[model samples]
Target: MTITKKTVIVTGAGGGMGRATVEHLLEAGANVVGCDLNIAALAELEENPRFKAMKADLLNEAAVQHIFAQTKSEFGSIDGLANVHGIAQHATPIEDCSLAEYRKIIDVNMTSIFLTCREAAAYMKEQGSGKIVNIGSVSTTRPRPGLQAYVASKGAVESFTKALALELAPYQVNANVLHPGPADTSMLGEFTAVGSSVDDTKKEVFESSVPLGKLLQPEDIAKSVKYLLSDAAEMITGAVLHVDGGRNI
Candidate 1:
């Protein structure tokens, strides 16, 4: 847990889990740059000396590069990256899922990671040290029906992170994936099938599916992200850490 004074960039900083991670890292004394397409949710953190909110789209190449460049210019170095931004797929069969819809999900979920990781790797590799934690989903392991596209995207994240770990090992940059299961976020309700009751699906389908019988809190995922970014996990690379409450079992 030695992240004090480190500079970490967190994507999706406006969302439930992302916001939590930003808070946790700031509390741990890390200089945090929170990026999101819309950063209205992070307004309260604007006054914090250790926090910076950047409104940028991860899908844009220039925007991604700017995030890293600005981080370096302001913080002097980038020590860690937490790829907490992502999208959920509505439960829809592949046959009914338009290719356009599939591409959007893949672009946002997988491609965005590519953009950020690629930019981070450049600076990190040069510095000879860094940590990368990409937030995936337990759905890759225990996918529910009609979430084929989402599963595929997250599965790609796991593989990509492993590849990154091996390629960047020589440079002392560690890469890993954190797959969360059935988090109690607004994003969870988005996974419900069309015309289905969101509350019922959360209780009957998502909550009950977890062996722990409780939905995961965003804080649960944030703490793990902190560990993966800290000195304690320096030797950990290419690992899939599940914060899923046994949902993947």
Candidate 2:
């Protein structure tokens, strides 16, 4: 199947998984608009004619709505969306976690995706086709004590994808999630143990988690998302594509 030029919106595109997804989607010949709260990171892509980066806080529903409005104005319509923006905890123990922190994760990781899908689905329904790709975690089904908010948010993401898929199926709008093992991102370094500055030990732990004995890369996750947005996955929806080197299995 051939996938032609399409309009795609990638959230959290300032960097990390969002950065990787946009790169792959653009490489696949899609025009991209990325929403990110980091203005500088968003500005870095200003040189690309096919890539437009908007600095907006997805955690704010109004900001999410405005971002999509601008997205539609930029390109007549959006054909795909990659929900790669999410946040992890600061490694505080469960008892030490604050209500504020929990709310922050829920708003950014869960609520933001809901707003994106809701607004995107409206546009896609009119176009009669669209793709939604969400970034989920292996921790949804697995346990990670210090990451309570993150885990809960991902669990919601899985359910949200499923529910949205069933509702959009008649309109040919597909929603799916991708769960990836640990990868090297700026956020990863921040979420590491207190002692070490580098990510060697962190990488080692993730590599050890999977039978593959290596940490998965952003490109690895991007590849799976690319497939889901391609015509190859035309018949697929509500699938939680696992790109964790068999670790989540």
Candidate 3:
């Protein structure tokens, strides 16, 4: 848990899991840059000296560059990165899933990780050390029906992270993926079929699908992200951590 004074970049910092990670890191005494498309949700932390809220679309290459440059200038180094921003695909038959819909999911969920990780690698390589934790989904391992695009996107995340781990290993930079199962975030409801009751789906489908019989909380993921970014996990890389309450089992 020795993350004091480290500088970390957290994408999707406005979302449920992202905000929780930001808060957890700040509590651990790290200088945090919380980036998202809309950072209004993080306004409450504007007063915290350790937190910097940056609003930028990760798909834009220029904006992504600025996020890293500004982080380096402000924090002096890019020590860790937690990519938590992602989109969920609604349960839809392949016949109804258009190319546009599938591409959008891939761009948001996978391309964004590419952009951020590219920036992180450049900085972390120069510094000779860093950590990267990409947030994947448990669905990649145990996918539900009608979620082909979502599963494919997250599957790519896990593979990409493992490749990054090996590439950065020489520089002492660790890269890993975290797959959360049936989280209790707003994104959970987005996975329901069109016209399906969100609550019923959560209780009967998503919740019951887990062996632990409970949905994961945002804080649960935040804790794991913090550990991955901390010295406690210094030797860990190319690992897929399942924080999904036995859902993958």
Using lDDT as the yardstick, the better of models 1 and 2 is 1
Poorly placed runs, candidate 3 (over 4 Å): none
lDDT of 2 by residue, 96-117 (tens): 7789989988888898898889
In candidate 2 the C-alpha lDDT for residue 153 amounts to: 89
Give the local distance difference test score of model 3. Answer: 0.97
TM-score for each of the candidates: 0.99, 0.93, 0.99
**Structure candidate 2, residue pairs in collision:** none
lDDT of 3 by residue, 1-249 (tens): 699999999999999999999999999999999999989999999899888999999999999999999999988999999999999999999999999999999999999999999999999999999999999999999999999999999999999999999999999999999999999999999999999999999999999988999999999999999999999999999999999999999
Worst 10 residues of 1 by lDDT: 139-148
Tell me the lDDT of candidate 2: 0.82
Show where candidate 1 strays beyond 4 Å. none
After superposing candidate 2, which stretches have Cα over 4 Å from the reference?
42-44, 193-200
Error of 3 at 111 (Å): 0.7
lDDT of each: 0.96, 0.82, 0.97
